[model samples]
Structures are given as C-alpha cells and as structure tokens.
Target: MSAAGQTTVPFTVPSFAGEVSDAVVKVLDSGWVTTGPQTAAFEQDFADFLGAAHVVAVASCTTALELCLRAMDLPPGSAVLTPSLTFCGAINAILHAGHRPVLVDIDEDTLVPSPETVAAAAARTRPAAMVVQNQGGYPVDVAALTEAAGLDRTRVVEDAAHGPGAARDGAPVGSSSYAACFSFYATKNMPIGEGGAVATSDPDFADRVRAMRLHGMSKDSWKRYLPGGSWRYDVKSIGLKANMTDIQASIGRAQLAALPGWQRTRGELVARYDAALADLPGLVLPQRDLAGVQHAWHLYQVRVPDRDALIAELEAAGVATSVHFIPASHMTSYRAVLGEEECGRVPVTDRVAEELLSLPLYPGLSPDGQDRVVTALTGALRARS
Candidate 1:
C-alpha cells in the first residue's frame, strides 16, 4: 500500500537527452531540414533494425496507417477488421481510405484481438484487410491471426504503435508478416517527438507506401538533388502530405541507438511490477507470453473491477494513469455507423473496456516511483474489498 499520504515524488518525464540532442544538432547545422538525407538514412536504419525489406518514415502513425490503406486501394464499403481496443488513428485511416472499419473484440488477457474473434469477423465480413494492433506492446500472435483469416483475399496490417523493438518468436514486430506501423511518438518506446514508420516484406507494397507518403511523386526530394536529377516531376497519383522530415528522423536515429538499453530496463521494471502486485485480490495482472516474443512494455495495462474508482484513488496518491481505449464503435462518429445495440455485440471489448486501466510505466520511471504505483494500486484495490 502507498505509505500514508505521500503525494509527491520525483517527477519522471520521457526524455530525448542522450544522443538525441546531438543528432538534432546535426540536422540544425545541415540547414536543409525537410525530407532529406537524414530522413532517408532513418528509413534505411529503421528497416535494418526491424530486419524488414523496406521502411518508410512518415509524419505520424496516423499518416503511416492512412497512407497504407490508401495505397492498398481497397474498394468502397470494403470492411477492414480492427480491434476495438486500439487508438482511433487506425479506425480513422480505414474510414478515410474508403473502407468501413469492422470493429472486433480483444482477448481479455492479451488486450489484442484473439484469433477466434478475428476468424469469426473475417468469416462474416470477408474483410479487405485485418488491421491487428500489438496492443500496449504485447505482440499479437501474428501466425495465429493470419491462419485464422486464412491465406487468400484478406491481408493483415499490424498497427504497432507501441512496438518499435517488439518481437514475436524471435522476429521483430514489423518483420514477421504484412505491413506493420510503428510510432515514434513522444510517449512511445522510441521517441521522435511525433513521427512513425511502416515496414513490410512486400516490395510492391513498400513502393506504394513510399510514393504515397510524398504526394505520389515518383521521385523523392533527395533523388531530385542527384547529379543527373531532372527538374520536372510528374504527379504519379493524388496523394497526401505525410512525409517525415530530416529533423524528426535525426531524433529517431538517436532514439534507435538508445532503444536496446531502454528495452532491457523496461523488462526489469515489468518484472518488479509483476512481483510486487502478484497476489492482490481483484487485480488482474497484465499477462505475458514469453514463449517466442519479447514484449516492448509500452503501457502496463491491467483489468480491475472498479477501474475508474481505482484510477481516482491512484491519482490521489500521486500516480498517473490512462485507459488504452474506449471502443471506437462507441464514439459519436463511429456510433452513427455502429449503433449502441449493434456495438454491444462485441462482448469482450464492451465488457473489458470498463475494466482496462493503464498504469504509469516508462523508461524514466524510477524503482521508487514504480514501487509507489504498485503500492497505490494494490492498496486501492484492497480497500474496495
């Protein structure tokens, strides 16, 4: 339990100190800050890090997701199966790209859409694609989900917003299957202030994403500066402005350097939290499947009976908390498409939405700070009984 009335502790903010500043300094010194050399290098380096065939850096994860959907060129009204337990960006992307997002349920323990639910949804909708999220950094069983959807017709797009160094069965998150999106958002495992990337094994898909990320211009800004580079360029396709800048890429490059050490520290913290909160009644600990994958530990989310009450209690004790989602179908915009009664049919998502709460867990979090969170949560849940 949190020690009596201790409300203040060391404030831990996500940082970009180490090599981040130095890298950014280089970008500043270079003068040309827009999508240029650093951005190209970052894309190549990120691809290498994930062992992916190609990687495209973009302004944000939303852009990455949107661009992927747009590049795929799905038919109007085509259903794209996605988890209800994800950020709205993926859902919005599906909608913006001329498809309907068929929201699905997530497994209670994993917080990711289960193979069973995905199979059921696919069977019903025969979706154009399945946008599976590595919910809260816990790698979804890609093989299982892929198998569930069956080979032909439906493609899988991994929304790995919380995954950068994440893995499944010893393979990096973006390397395993279809197009995988990674966020280098301010709060992600690797901070790029606000940016993202999409990696894939498919060469054609990668090319399409690359083209779309920069107004569908066949040649990028870098290529235009080459020795024999032509001045005139054609608009290959009507595309959006979603390219990543050299400045952001410089930050991403630096963060990539520090990623391994930070991931190791995250593992240690998860272990400590797991041990500290182990036998608390009514508190469902976040589950981990260490069989093949290495968790990125983006946000340590758990289920509790009175989650809102628990969050209040923890906040009063000086702990910050967040909820991963509030089912997209339940939101006003989506609700118009999927009414209350229809949305409630996704039983697992509907029920778990009330129970899910994310605890404070990040690289900067100190052992003492973590202890405080554990004590606060355990005591809060215990008090209810």
Candidate 2:
C-alpha cells in the first residue's frame, strides 16, 4: 500500500537498480547482443556465486529443467518423482523430457515434500529420479531427502527456481544437487525480466546442457560468429532452442552484484512479517528461521482460514494477495497427462493449496506499505470473525 491515496499493495514487485538499465544499454551498444560474452560471464559469475563446478545459462528455468532431465538418459517414460504443490514447470519438464511424472505429496507446514513423504512416495513409485524444489525460497536438504528416499545423489534434480541465494547444509543451493535450476523471472529474488540457469558439478552434464540448449550444436553461435570464426557448426543431436541473450545476461550480471543487499532486505522484511503476524488468529505463517539455512524470502505466504473470503476482504481494504500454487495435479492440463491414477492422493498438497496465500513481498515494499497491508489484513480477518 502507498502512503499517499493508499493504493492497493501488489502481491509482488520487480525491484531494479540503475545498473540493470545501464548494463542493458551497454549490451545494446556492443556489437554482440545475443548469447555471447555477456551470457558466458553471467554463467561463470553464477557458478562462482554458488560454488558450482559448472553453470549453463538458459532461456528459462523450465527450459533448464527440461535440458537437465533430457541429459539424464533415463529409459523413456521413466518415473520422475516431483512435488504436486510445485510449479507446473517441473512436472512439464519431466513430461517434455519423455518421462512420466509421479507427483509426491508435501509436508503441510513446509509446503514441500518432506523426507518422510519423499521416502514413502519413492517406495511406492520406485522412481528413477526426483525433482526437489526449494519451495518459497527455503532451500531443501537434498542430501537428506536423497538419503531418505534411498536414491543415488546423481538422480536428484533440484527445482531451485524460487531460490538462487538460499543456502542449506552449510552450502549454497546449486553447489551440490546433481543438477539445480534457477529462475530470474521478473518477480523472483534475482529479477532478469525472464531468464534462468542450470548449475552442476558434473562436467558432462554441463556440456550436454550447453549443447542441447541451442540445437545440440558442436559450436555455439558466439564461437562461430566472431571475427575469423567459421559460420559452419555441427548439430550432433536433437535439441531445443533455449539460449539466454546477452541483454538478459547483462542485466543478470548487474543484478548479481546487487543480490546480497537485496536478499538482506528481504530477510529483514520477512522478520517484520513474522513478528507482526504471529498474534493474528487462525493464520499459519510460512516456514522461517531454519537452522544453518538462509531463506531467500521469495514469498511471504500465510495460510488463513476462509482463504477466499479473506482475499475478498483484503481486496476491499486495498491489499493484494495471491496463492503460491495450485497443485499441479489439480490443473486440467496435467490431469490429461497424469490421469487420476498416476497423480493420486497428494493429500497434504491438496489440502494446503486451498490455504496458501502469498502476501506482498519485494525489495521495494516499504515498511509503511507493509504496515498498511498488515492493518488491512487484520481488519479483514476481524470483519470475517
């Protein structure tokens, strides 16, 4: 909410500093503006940031996930266990990679499949691999989850789309997952308008992702188009076109420099939200303050009784709210592919989807605006009571 005229608070805002625009302008001015040096720099910088052995920049997190899955070389239609409460992209990526998705149930509190849930699901499905998401920017303990599921570490793929800056088990995300995907969507912690990446320690996996992202080419255009470079390139295998552009990478590079401060701001804001909403009746605050973990605070979600009614009330009070997700199994498109039998009874995911409500969370959201949101939310809840 704004202090003047009290504008409605939006659920998310894409915060940007001046450097992003400056970087974009620089890229535009440079002769090369596609997937060239800027993209390469961003990939290297991201790898350094996460302490990963390799990183491949891509067009979107979904694309990165697909490419990673494709590199798995699993038997066609292999079962890939994934959370039902996660973004549809993870499930879609599995299907796109010629695999079957087995939707795993989530922990009601964490809004992610717990080790126990994953273990149970894995036992039932005997999955070939799993997509573990860092739900709401809170990193998952993939090592523990993998152990609980009795799966090899190499078979786990991380859907870290919500969190690029989050840390778990004494290491940053993308540091250890066999492969981890990240997003730089407009509303994400690292806003790049629309971009994503794949980070991994496996050199072969990185090479495969790089080749597949641009038509399985032996040489990327950047290498082929530079002065004294040959136009000829070899297509070694079937692949998709999902390369990140230099303009996006330029902005991403600038954003990377600004990320730490932005994350700190998010943490501070989340702290206020935790303290303020603690007293609100019938409200379930999101997972917070895990030991040895740094939450990215991507979405400050709260589960409220009468979620629909509260949203309407909040709307009337000039406050905006949105849900993190509707279970992928609940959506029609996935239903057509998964069918009822395949995606059966993600009981916790189904129940929690109704109550999960994402509140206003962004670097630009002022304390007063947050206060206004809180006041409106409190009023709305009180009215319903």
- Which candidate number would show the highest lDDT if scored against the true structure? 2
Segments in model 1 whose C-alpha atoms lie over 4 Å from true places: 1-12, 151-154
Please give each candidate's TM-score.
0.94, 0.96
Q: Pick the candidate with the highest TM-score.
A: 2
Error of 1 at 244 (Å): 0.3
Query: lDDT (CA) for every model shown?
Result: 0.82, 0.88
Which ranges of candidate 2 are over 4 A from the true structure?
1-5
Task: Work out candidate 2's RMSD over C-alphas.
Answer: 1.9
For residues 1-385, write the lDDT of model 1, one tens digit per residue: 3344665443235657578878888889988889989998999988888998889899889888888878777777788888877788888988888888877777787888888888877787777777889888888887788778773422778888998778887898987556888898888888878999999888888888888888899888778987899877778777888999999999888888888888888898889988998898887888786688778899888889888877777777878788988888678888887677656658888898899888877788888888888888888888878
Give the TM-score comparing model 2 with the true structure, all chains together. Answer: 0.96
* Model 2 CA lDDT for position 210: 95
Task: Report each candidate's C-alpha RMSD, comma-separated, in the order given.
Answer: 2.3, 1.9
